[model samples]
Target: MKIAIHQMNSGIDPAVNRAAMDIAIRSASNQGAHFYFAPEMSLLLDRNRERGRIHIQHESTNRHIAALCDTAREAHIWVHVGSVPVLSEDGSGRFANRTLLIDPAGQIVARYDKMHLFDVDLATGESWRESNAYAGGTHPVLAQSPLGPLGLTICYDMRFPDLYSRLAKAGARAFAMPAAFTVPTGKAHWHVLLRARAIESAAFVIAAAQSGGHEDGRETYGHSLVIDPWGEILLDMGDGEGLGFVEINLSRVDEVRAQVPVHLNRRVIPPLD
Candidate 1:
């Protein structure tokens, strides 16, 4: 099925982001896309810790989330919202960076909160303290969809291979690694990391990314991508801020796995101990 990977440069305004997404959804649906995959933080991209602290709301009550779900239902297509910043269930006043799987009926069938919090202090003097504002999720989600089984992951989670392997073993045929990757790290590791994940797991990888400069003065590396199971890049949206589409071939998952058999070749560390 055709999947539209929507790359966006969302700012602090939820309304503007939603409007852009709405247009993309309609355009993708018109082009016969079965699914729409939006970049992480598709609703808003505010780097001001103080502002973001006040901006997040519970998913059930968040109008931005409701609006996106409505768009999915109206378009009659599945949508993988890379994530939404929401109130954590613990009620610690911290939010969760959560990914939701909205079916064609606009019902949320699965949700994956990002487990890894980005807490890096960059050499360029850029520092992020995601843990201060958001709580990390413990569980991994491998969701079953009409198109295929998808292993859901957020930006920082892409750096971990064990999660992808676990999802692959759980019968996931495709992986979603939506991200709002910073320009520096993205230019250095994005493609290689994604390709490695696909090659190791023998699963298709679809990554929708946030692009361009945002209201917070933070620049993100776009290059939204789709990679085959064989690690070949099938599509790259480049640095532009727009929605792009690609055809997902599930058969390649099996074909590449059969050829490499990395899944079966994994050896036990201490004689299966």
Candidate 2:
């Protein structure tokens, strides 16, 4: 299966972001890609934290996500609309970072709310407390695809290996991590962490990332990539905006698992206090 990973630089304007995504999707479709993945916050990137809350509440019916579904239907392909800010049911005015999977028929097959919150103080004199603005999810999400069972994850979830391990144990053959990663952290940990996850699970890893600078003046380390079961990066897009694509052979999963069999060689261990 050919998968296209889009390195997108989304801004505060929904119209501009949607237009850019459409062009990228059309290009990928023309190249015969069966699956397309977009970066986190693919629709709008609001710098003003206070306004984000209002925007999420009013823009519950995301035009960009709907477009992705329509594009998938037109191209007869599967599309993962990375992560978008969605309003919760309560009128308490909080949002959830959610990922939506659209099938070829333009129907939503699965939706995953990001479980991990990115609350940290960066060395660049920037601090973020996502929990203050967004609600955390409590469930793990796994979706079925033509390729195989796919485990869903968002940006900060990459730091938690237990989540990935549980998904692998649940028979996930492929994993997707769509992120709007900061340049400093991504440059230091992105490749290593992604490859480590693939090596540990022996599953194909697909990462679609935010590239370049956003309207909010935030810079991201773009290198969107697809890693094979053997931990080899099949495709990589370094910096700037572009698409990285590769033909992934699902059979390689069995071969890699057979070689290591780490999933089968597990031992019950006690947790540290």
Candidate 3:
């Protein structure tokens, strides 16, 4: 299947971001891509810590999601909208970073809330506590795709190998890690971590990333990549804003698994007594 990954520089305005995404998707569709993916924070990027505290109802409604679904239907392709901030249910001033999966017919098939929160102090004197502004998701999500079973995760979840391991054990053949990774950490760990996850799980890894500077003046790592089961990079977008795509053979999953057969090499040992 041919898949396209978009690297976008989103800002505080949803209209601008949506327009940019539309152009990218149209271009990919014109190129005959069967599936397309956008990076995290695809809708809006509010760097103002104060502005982040406000939770809006319209943001969580299905309107924006419907628009992406319409795009998918018109293009007749599977579309992953990365992550968008939605209002939390309890009427509290909290939000959820959620991912929407639109099928070829423009129907939402699955939704995955980001399970990991990015809370850290950067070396450049920038600190972020995601838990303060967004509610954390408790469950792991896996969706059925035309290619096979796909594991869903966002930004910080990429750092947790166990999550991917569990998904692999549950029969996930592909993994999606959509991220708006910080420039500092992304430059150091992005490719290595993504490649490691693909190698360890022996699954295809599709990473759609945020690129360039945002409205908040924060820079993001923009190298979107697709790695095959054998850990070979199929497509790399480099350090800029654009669309990256490649044709992936889903059958390669079984081929690679037969070679190593690591999944069957598990040895259970007794714990300390």
Clashes in model 2: which pairs?
Answer: none
RMSD of model 2 against the true structure: 1.6
Task: Encode model 3's per-residue lDDT on 1-273: one tens digit a residue.
Answer: 888999888888776788888778778888999888998889877867576444234343646566777888887888889988888674666788888888989888988888889999988998998888788888888899976999989989999988998899889999988899998898899999999999888899999998887788898988898999899999889788888778989999999999988788855657899
TM-score-better candidate, 1 vs 2: 1
Which candidate gets the maximum TM-score versus the true structure? 1
Instruction: Rank all candidate structures by their TM-score, best first, as comma-separated numbers.
Output: 1, 2, 3
Instruction: Determine the C-alpha RMSD for candidate 3 after optimal superposition of all C-alphas.
Output: 1.8
Better of 2 and 3 by TM-score: 2
TM-score: the better of candidates 1 and 3: 1
Collision count of model 3? 0
The lDDT leader among the candidates is 1
Alpha-carbon TM-score of each model against the true structure:
0.97, 0.95, 0.94
What are the candidates' C-alpha RMSDs? 1.5, 1.6, 1.8
Model 1 poorest 10 in a row by lDDT: 264-273
Candidate 1 has which clashing residue pairs, if any?
none
- Name the lDDT of candidate 1: 0.90
Tens digits of lDDT, candidate 2, 1-273: 888999999988777888888888878889999998998888877757775555564333766677777888887888888888888655657788888888989899988889999999988897888888788878888899976999999999999999999999999999989999999999899999999999999999899999887888888889998898899999889988988789999999999999999989977788888
Q: Which ten residues in a row are the worst by lDDT in model 2?
A: 51-60
